[model samples]
Target: MRSSPVSRCRMHCYFETGSPMCGGGTRTVFSKRRAGSGVLSPVREGSTLTHGAQKGSISNYEVYLGALVGTLLGAAPAVLADNPIIQTLYSTDPAPYVWNDTVWLFTGHDEPNSDWFTMKDWRLFSSTDMVNWRDWGKMMSVETFSWASADAWAGQVIERNGKFYYYVPVTRKGSSMGIGVGVSDSITGPYKDAIGAPLVANSAIDPTVWIDDDGQAYLYWGNPNLYYIKLNEDMISYSGGINTVDLSSFQGHFEEAPWLYKRDSTYYLAYAGHCCSEDLRYSTAPGPTGPWTYRGQVMPTQGSSFTNHPGIIDYKDGSYLFYHNGALPGGGGFTRSVAVEKFEYGSDGSIPTMDMTTEGAPQIAPLDPYARVEAETIAFSSGLSTEPSSDGGGIHVTSISNGDYIKVKGVGFGDSGAASVSLRVAAANGGAKVELRLGSRTGAVIASCSVDATGGADVWKTISCPLSGSATGQQDLFFNFVGGGDQNLFKFNWWQFARK
Candidate 1:
């Protein structure tokens, strides 16, 4: 399938809506001209470029020419991404923690076709721009906790005193459910069971941990009820007894997943509220253990999932809410996907109700096209998976078939324009061609490079291809794969574009 030249030209105008070339206005239309014309006749800036413009008003030739000029002049359009940030896997119960400029996301991996929350492991991913997330792969799983038997459910990790601690709920032997703590020296960990047993067992789940300004730490978790514990300096051990907070003032049914944090001396507790199909709600207190006051719903009963988990954090001067829903294809209550939304708090430090959106969050900054971008770093992807390279290095893209593509959004090519693209690829099979498209799957093909087999899949090689079309400005790049058979085509490690 391919977009008609006329439609492509119209899209180009739409993409350039808010640029100086278009008078920093809305849509602009070019005057009509014959197809295959060498030159683009200029139309007045801010002219309305509708799809069904009257004949002789905006010619298809002018539209195409405008696109070409826009690209050559380094006026690339910004591509905004939608929700369900991770496409290659089903993620749920998002737990985001900021460590050194990047937001580290730890989520429950929902097994495909799961009928009843059959989660067995957790996944870790991180992002600085929010739009492009780098997959860190499986961080820890059921086997991580030796004493625990099954159910690697929702959890939260915190860094303290040069050590990282993860609190999660799992099924303990001879018990229904218990919360366990895992400790590691690094944030991304092969964590060890800190306390060879459940830290606090009471048929509870969904553990959220937070540390206060005065060097005190607290762990909160439970479903249908809320519990808290004061941890000692070691973090793995707690001195105080488990205390349950009074939820009589909470607006809705307080279920589980308590996210505790502090801002401006006020302590906030956000949790999944109401029954069955859960919505997010919160309460505030003057102290960590509160004489709490119910604030109200943060997110309403939306998204297809029956239950919801909340992870809230403030990063890069913006507040964000991370949750899960059955919004992906073949997703449901059991099989869910994680998503995020940028939000604002009320004037009084109270959280306002936020709705779920496909457009999750805006990019913090544009991606530099000249840098060596990992193939696994993706804003959006289709028909592909990532794995550790066999050469004992960083991650690489795999499970690629014909029509498989990876979309890197907001790539800024600069004014000079990119002359060529370089890729580190490997293929045991014959080889394949990667078509570089802009805007959409059937959008304009700017470049195509045939990757040659490097004798084996693990045998790596560098390949370069000259870009044929305009490659300037900020545009969403689509690396579309095409091959002869239905098997794997090749593996891509990293890619970058060089300026002319």
Candidate 2:
């Protein structure tokens, strides 16, 4: 088998909204704060460290020394991320597009606790530093296409003529898998179906789109065989009939997930090669449609998932390869997670073999903490979920419980330091504190602000608290949740720091 056609699976499952598998919960507002207190332990700062009054205090000198000591000891910077980049949900089939200075990652959402590929919608996540990603939530879904019934499998997005177009494979009603195109004015979109019907419908899947310097666009996709169609300037339609790639002329077993990119003058086609367990392989051509010469493996078969997908792009003088793996807790073939690796092509323009890792690509630059940062923007998170805010402000972090934490890696607090921080939060039940910690989750508490009920979980409030210790330079910032009771604590919208 070239690759398992997920749409061909005999079994399928769909969960209703707000189910346990979706991590849904109830919310209620309380006037009184819950009865409980937690010990606030600051990093050792001689005798200056104090813990009480729902706040912790530490010395500025110690913060500086700790940073210096960590640097001297060669401690891995928090900016360096762990793999399976997405922790809040299972995101698969990464399609990375570089627009302006940010990398916009479009992926398909794998439903939780699924026995088979149960995908309904597509998601969008973007990052400036590539370590901390802000979830843009659902960009589009099968619901967007009235004619499509299921299989929001793999898709790719491209920007042309200032408009963003998404190409995805969906199961057509009473028919086989057909490709659909979505278009949006903004990169972050509420995309609409560009064409009411399948752009092309021969049971082909995993659509990857690329445009050449000559203003000609190409859409490539298929399994068991390879095919391409020259897309017109409109993007919603094609210029000619479907064309097939001569698989026999090309080297290697080209399974599926065809990613097309042009490096200088060479056209490269990277795909999932072999079956049962897939590895990444590529072939190079002098032109867009190839007499492709087999280039060896880009990534060997590894990770927990049996199937693999590839998305490659170059951003900010660096080359990155994005792929899917079942590396997260409870992750498997049907519930896959997307991970990225930084790699360099051989001087001859051939790709080098890369490995999937927990410590994913390093932060190209530190994140600016002074700016307003969305709570859903995370490098790593534990015990929390994200959903659309009731205030119509995109997505917010929800389902927060005691000990839940969101880590923002490589946060540059700067030399002047931060004086205080304000958080946009909502709480149904009171008795929760957002602890601002540095370095490690347990490293040191700089500020701990108690959150009170804001009338409803949907009713948001902004609370500001002073920072007791100096938070300067580049550091990994952890928003550690501490509260009493097992019920949901609060919902986090966004946060920003005030300069000292």
Candidate 3:
């Protein structure tokens, strides 16, 4: 039995109408189906197994061999490599696509407020898990865009009429950093600015290009206005009135930076808000042009402070949010490191849980350094420890010494490799807010930022804290020996780590 590629999110199964023993098997399942023409849809059936087990027939082990879900993408299996993970695949912004079984994203090669601000460069990274990322060095440059003397903020890659188009925003001192267009032949490219003109400058920052279901095209800018345009058959030029969506209706919403996508007959309008520092909330809407609604707050999902800046990607039979979190580190807010969580539509027809990290979604492999790891309770002695209530499996930490130093051991899969453990610590007496420190090395603090914990108890939810100390690619971790707080009790469900 073989399943047919129905759409980007599903497969049209062709089965022999009998059980496996009857010389027949099922190809197409109900959960996913072929992406037919028009708006995408929810197949709803095959998603669940005999019990309440989630996940389709897809298996992680087979992913390496390029096993596929369906044809919606021609290069299906090629994109399923989520292991030997690529740490961070995101560049300055989120670039998405629907062709192969992966989402190919483009971003910058450096960070801001750092040393590499003036020298603008680009890179290409793709992933199916949205966890690990693959970095394809320097693809474009400041020289590619017309007025881009420096600063390539928000740029989008759109494929239409058989050609690839890259749209970017640039600025040079007094001259407003406007949006410029770049053209390329391959997904990875040395794109040249198309019109030799800013895609649309004067007040616009990040520029995005979205093609509608009708095959008609539109260009969205970062001006708090949903700019619309019709693509000339080649999808190279603009044709319609630049429509404006007055987001003024919502407060704490600014900076524009938008990405538009369509799903199940509805359009999802995603954009970053709040200051460049924090208060960032990744939002969505029902149409490209909208009475946009606030789904959830973005940035700094963990501790407080501010956390804005992000990009959204839909892949792996799910929609995932990719953005840099405000991890308490030397450059926490400014680092702009990438992290991902499955973005699901909430019950009220709005965005679902934006709990910083998508807590339980099958942890996918990543594409860059600060490689992602989960929290688990693998040890227990005296003192105290935190473990997942849902699945009594993971790492276990017990207090030693003065309850200041906590030791953790792998539980579930037995040290797939020497795992580096990070403990999410909240101040014993509201000390330094709440911080995350590594327990392995004597005195290392990875992320010093803290956030809204139940507060009553010292209990904190332990997650795969990014490795910050040493170079195993773990993020926001430095072996800060976990413990403290009179009520140092916290809720730790899982621990994410990569066994080297």
Candidate 4:
């Protein structure tokens, strides 16, 4: 379980009508700083954004605000509303990893509204709360593997010995499919090919890695057939020879995409069963390489996609299954999106069948609006797309049009409420406004900031807007774009709130 960081709190008086009372107490707020830094400005006397508790000057409002902020200081609500967890792009072959208290999601990107499996590179996203995922564009690509020409397919990542290893399927130039590995010190990586050659050149796909309790690592991948190799501590290499799992003892039909994991003393292997329109099924074994027994379906064939892939993990005392489906607006077999569902194992250790849902996974924690949050960190959005930031650091929300909006769930503005908001944006065609709304896209407007041309779409600037009109308590925050033009309004990078 993750603990909440100590927050810099303030006091404010509110009327029964829910408007700020103002003038009764000394209002204190904090200056904008990078989110998650845990550093606050030194408290000064009579400052609007002061920090720490004010002794003897406490009032009922102060007590109420203090207690309210304290009670809600921990995890916030989820920002997600439905399936296809990410709406910015078509993300498929979901691979989620938990490290350093965060879930790092790696997926293959499908070309916009393509007809085939047109994948070029792999993408990355991270989240503390399951709903609002932050986009980290293009972790590694076919370009990352020099010898590989095309097909950046399904893969999995595992962390070992302070190094992160990514095992993925790629096609070596003129040759068959091979499993390639990349390594980096950071989970959000500038990963390089660990070995310039393919780790396993077996003409197979969908690689999943598992590190056992005894510290032995295993790599599993294939379609129509299942294969595994005992990986050395280095992870880039394997010991002994490649081994195959016999399918005769399997109960259900097996097509491809095998995910191996162990819970308690039982080993589980979940895979896509049957081709054309595949269903998610699994089997169990006592060890990593099993004389396996096929279990029933994990998920029956559903969604718009003709194929499905599964990635499962136990996070925050909950079991989550990550998979992809053709459920987006232009989604199909080629244009797929990732979605997750929270599930529990049966008392006998069998996975109960689950249905694909738009609600996705429930928010395990609430989002802190007082902290700096990336524009790409979204729960639900419409009429927008994301791209590599103009500043070249990370991704920013882009392709935004008038009337398009982004929704962030469970924003804890606290009882004191927000005083102002800061936005980092860039505009090629200027004259756009960001309307900060509460509850819904058409909800109560708390603030709006005008955006002017920044010379180019990539040229960046920061703007601030003063907030007002009952923006208190924990509520869903929406960034509604309003502008006039056929072109995009502006590119958004990040946003932060100053406490009232």
> Which candidate tops lDDT?
2
TM-scores of all predicted structures: 0.82, 0.85, 0.52, 0.83
Model 1 clashing residue pairs (backbone): 31-59, 32-58, 32-59, 33-59, 83-358
Estimate, for each residue in 197-278, the C-alpha lDDT of model 4 and write its tens digit. Answer: 9999978688989999999999988776778999999999989999998889775387778889999999999888764456
How accurate locally is residue 18 in candidate 4, as Cα lDDT from 0 to 100?
Answer: 30
Cα lDDT tens digits, model 2, 369-394, are: 78999999998876677898886669
Error of 1 at 314 (Å): 1.0
lDDT of 1: 0.75
Residue ranges of candidate 4 with Cα displaced over 4 Å: 1-81
Per-residue error (Å), model 4, residue 256:
0.4
lDDT of each: 0.75, 0.77, 0.43, 0.75
RMSD (Å) per prediction: 14.0, 10.9, 20.8, 17.9
- lDDT winner between 2 and 4, please give it: 2
Clash counts for the predictions, in order: 5, 1, 74, 8
lDDT value for candidate 2?
Answer: 0.77
In candidate 3, stretches whose alpha carbon ends up further than 4 angstroms from where it belongs are: 1-91, 112-119, 172-174, 223-228, 280-286, 291-307, 326-329, 358-500
